[model samples]
Target: MADLIEKILSIEGGALAITRDTAAKLVNNLVQNGEVKPEEAQPLIDELVARGEAERDALREDLAAQVTTLQNTTQSIQTMLNANIKEAPERAIHELVLLGEQITNVQDRLREAEKQVEENTRQTLGQAQKQLRIAQARLVQATEEIRTGSIDEA
Candidate 1:
């Protein structure tokens, strides 16, 4: 209610005090501009800053978990590779066969998409050309009418 928020702006903590104060100032502007109501100011600021911090913390945790999972998976893959060292050549051949098949599939899909796009472009071009012809005919008819009218008046 009073102006004591400035004094206790960092009540959340030190580092986030700046974050909190900055958010409060921005939201306060919305209140001043009538975009946000005066009574809703403090709650809005608190909710926004808290939500941002929670999101940041959650992201950090998620990233750490993902990194750990990746490291574990890579280690497992290395162990498997070591154990299957004798079959490396066979595995390489099989993987190459699969990769080649995948490449062919992608190429076929890309060709189909390109053909569809070309057909669409051709249809659109035909429609545009037809419209242009119609417009030209109208223009010629209008010119002929104007010329005939001028000669009759003369």
Candidate 2:
């Protein structure tokens, strides 16, 4: 149970990770329930923030690499055109169109990757928020129980 809580708190904003708000609430509930120490929340929050930063850095690097790949493909196509300078204009144009098609294909794949990342992040954040709400409800119930001593007494 402790391991699971720790794992939940560790998730950061990313393709398949939770938001910082949700993570903080989860920790808050665990602390309220005596499952975790109140003092522990700060360290966990710091760790999650660091993880988010790292994921963002990685995503930026991946995007830059994709751009570099597209640039290289474009350069290759240009080189091919230069090599075939003696070819008829119509044939050269056809080759250029084919190369452009290849570049477009790459763009499509990158777009798909971007969409997947976006959708996954949104879903994960939603799930985390839902879980936090459930945890908060549980905390409220526990508090009411303490105040009333028993449902019958209330």
Name the weakest run of 10 consecutive residues (lDDT summed) in model 1.
Answer: 1-10
Clash count of each predicted structure: 0, 0
Q: TM per model?
A: 0.41, 0.43
lDDT of each residue in 1-154, candidate 1, tens digit only: 2233333344534224446667788778778888778888888778657755776787789999999999999999999988799688888999999999999999999999999999999999999999999999978877897878753333
Give lDDT tens digits, candidate 2, residues 39-90: 8887776666566667778989999999999999999999898867756686
Candidate 2, clashing residue pairs?
Answer: none
Best by TM-score: 2
